[model samples]
Target: MTTTTTWALARVLRDRDASLYLAGVVVSGFGTSALWLASGVWVKDLTGSDGLAALCMLAMWAPTLAGPFLGTLTDRTRRKPLLIGTNLLLAALLLTLFTVDSPDRLWLLFAVLFVYGAAGVVHDAAESALVAGAVPAPLLGDFNGLRMTATEGMKLLAPLAGAGLYAAYGGASVALLDAVTFVVATGLYACLRVRESRPEPRAGGRRKQTAEGARFLWAHPGLRPLVLAGGTTMLFAGLSGAMVYAVIDGLGRAPAYAGVLYAVQGAGSVVIGLASGPALRRLGERRFAAYGIALTAAAAGLRAIPSDPVALVCSAAIGAGLPCVLIAALTAVQRETPDALLGRTAATANSLVFTPNVVGLAAGAALVELLDVRLVSAVIGLAWLVTAVPLFQNPASASRTATRSPSDANPA
Candidate 1:
C-alpha cells in the first residue's frame, strides 16, 4: 500500500527530480524532532527550575513575529538556495547545542529556537512554493495529502528514536545525529532540479513582487476568512502545548504519559494525513476544513470535560483533527494564489496565524502558573472552539483547477 501511494504521489509530482525534495523534507524532519526532544531535556538538566524549562518552550513560536517580512523575502527570492541555506544553518545550531553547559546560556537556546522557527517559516513557504511550481494546482490537494502523510510518519518515528538516543547516548550524541540529518537533507535538496523562472504578474501588473503578493492576498475575499480561521486555531494550539506538562502533572501521570498521548495523536494524524487528498476530493477543501474546524472545536470542548480515560481519548481526537485543518488551509492558499506569490502567501498565512501562537504560549504559560493546568487547557480549548464558528457561518469553498503552465490563472 505504501508503495502504491508513493507511485501515485510520484505521478502527481510530474517530475522525477521532485522525489529528492520529499526525501530532503523527510531527513529534515528527523533532525528537527531529534533537536526538539533533546533541547528541552538538556535545558531541564541544566536548570532545576521548572520555570526556566517552561520559558524554553516558547521558542517554538517566537520567530513567527517576523513571518511577514520572511514571507516577503521568500516571494522575492528563489526557494532552493533558501532551503539549502537554512538547513546548513540549522546543522550548525544543532552542533552548538552540545557546547552549552550553564543555565545562564539558556537565553542562547531561545535565540537558536527563534532563529530555527524563523527558518522553518521559510522552509514551509518555500516547500509550498516549490510544490505549486512542480505540480498543477488542481492536483495540489492530493499531492499535499501525500506530503502530509509522509510528514506525520516522520513525526511518529523521530521522537521515539530521539528519545532512545538521548537515553542511551546523551544530548551531545542526539545533537550529532540531528546535525548529520541536516547535512544529508541538504545534499538531497542539491540533487533536485526545479526550473526557476520569473513568475507572471497577477491582475495588477505595476506592483513590486512583495507588494503585489500582499495586495493579492488582501484583495481575495475568501482568503481573508480562511486566514482568520487558521491563524486563530494555531494560536490556541500553541497554547495547548504549554499546558501539556501541567496536564500530565494534574492527572498524576508520568511525564512519559505526555509522550504517549502525543504518540497517539501522531498516530491519528498519520491516518488522516494519508487520506487528506481523498477527503478534499470528496468534500472539497472548504467543506473539509469546516468539518475539521468543527471537530477541533469538539475536541477542545472535550479537553474541558475532565481528566479521565474518555478525556484522554478526546485529547487524541484533537490531534487527529488538526492535520485536516492544516491541509484545508494550505490547499486553499495553494489553489487561490498565483505561483509567483506562493511563498509569500504561505508566509503571510503563517505569519497571521503564528503571531497568535506566540501570544497563546505566553497566555497558556501564565494560566498554568497562576490558575492550574486543567483550567488553562479548558480556557484555551474554548477559545479554539470560537475560531470554528466562522467556518460554519461562511464556508469558503472553491475548487481551483490546475493550470497548464505557471502563466495560467485559477490553476488547480
Candidate 2:
C-alpha cells in the first residue's frame, strides 16, 4: 500500500468512533455472511425444491427496490440512534427464526428475511451517512476499503462455520448464532461517539424529499457515470452467476466445487480491498472503476474455459475486479455529497446499482436453462467489455473532480 493509504487506515483505527463503527461492521457482517449461505441451504433442506430455495435469495434482495424511499429515514433522524435501533430490531427478528422448525413454517422464514432485507437497506443508509461524519475525508477511501475487506473476509470463513453448525444442529442454530452477533453489533453501534446535528426539515412535501437523492445523482457530472458503471457490471455479474453450476460440471467437478470457487474469490477480494485506496488515488474513481470492469470482462471470458485451474483463477479475478467498482463509487459519493443528503444519495445510488444484479440474477437463471453456458459466459463478457468503452472515452481527467476538503464535502 502507498503511504497515503497506510496512514489513512491507521488514522481510522486510531480514532475511537471510527474504530467502534468498524467493530460493528465486522460483527454484523459476519452474521450477515453466514446467514446468506445458510438461508438457501436451510430452505433447500426443508423443501427439496430448487425454486423455493432460490426464492429465499429473492426475498432477501427484494426490499432494496424501496431503498431510496426508506433511506429518507436516515435523513429524518440522528444516524447513530437509527443504526443501533436497526441492529437490535434485526436481532429480535432473527430470534423468530427459531420458531421455524418445519416446512409449514417456511412462510415465517421468508417473511423475516424480507423484513431483514428492508432493515438492511435502512441500516446501510444510516451507516453511510454516519461514516461521513465520523471519519475524515481523506480517510474515507481507506475506511470503505477496509470495510469491504472485513465483509469479504467473513465471507471466506463464515460460510464454513455456518454450514458446519447447520449440519450438526440445524438452521435454527445458525439463526441463533446470527442473532447473538447482531446483539453484539447493537452494543458496538451504541458505543460510537459522533457529533450529528439534527437535520433541518425540508420545505417541500415528503414526495419531493424522497426524490431528491435520485435527482441529485443524475445531475452530477462525475458521479453519474461511476454509478451507471456499477449497475452495468452487476448486470453481467448476474449472468456469470447463473453459469456457476455449468462451469463446475464442465470442469468435471462435483457441486462442492462451487464452494471452493467462492473461497478463492473471497481471497482475491481481500487483496483488492487492501489495494483499492491507492488505486483510487492514482487512477481517480472513473478510470479505476473502468479498469476494474475491464478486468471483470476478461475474467468472464476466462471462465468460459473448462479447465479447473482456469476456473479458480477466473473466480479470483471476478472477486478482485467487482469490489473496486463498488468501493470507488461509494468513496466518490462520500467525498462529493453534503452530509445532510448523504444518506439518501448513498441509498439511492446503491439501489440503482444493485437492483439490476437481482434482476439479472433472475433473468440469467432463466436464460441459462435455455442457452449453452459457455456461450452465455462469452456474451456476458462481451457486454461488459462494451460497457467499459464509454468509461474509457470519458476519463476522470476530463470530468469534474471530487471535493477535496472534508469541510467542503460534508457541510452540515
lDDT agreement with native, every candidate: 0.71, 0.85
Candidate 1 per-residue C-alpha lDDT over 300-328 given as tens digits, one digit per residue, 9 for 90 to 100: 65665446685578666876677776788
Q: Pick the candidate with the highest TM-score.
A: 2
Error of 1 at 242 (Å): 4.6
lDDT by residue (1-412, candidate 2, tens digit) is: 6787677678778988878888888898888888888999999998999999989889989999998899889999899888888888888889999998889999999999999999999999999988887888877777888899999999888888899999998998999989999999888887777877888977677777767787677667677888999998898888788789988888999998888998898888988888887788788888888888999899997788999889989999999999988998899888888787888899999998999997788788898899888888988898888887777765444233343322223211
Worst 10 residues of 1 by lDDT: 403-412
- Name the regions of candidate 1 deviating beyond 4 angstroms: 1-18, 103-108, 198-212, 239-252, 368-386, 393-412
Point out where model 2 deviates above 4 Å: 1-5, 395-412
- Which candidate wins on lDDT? 2
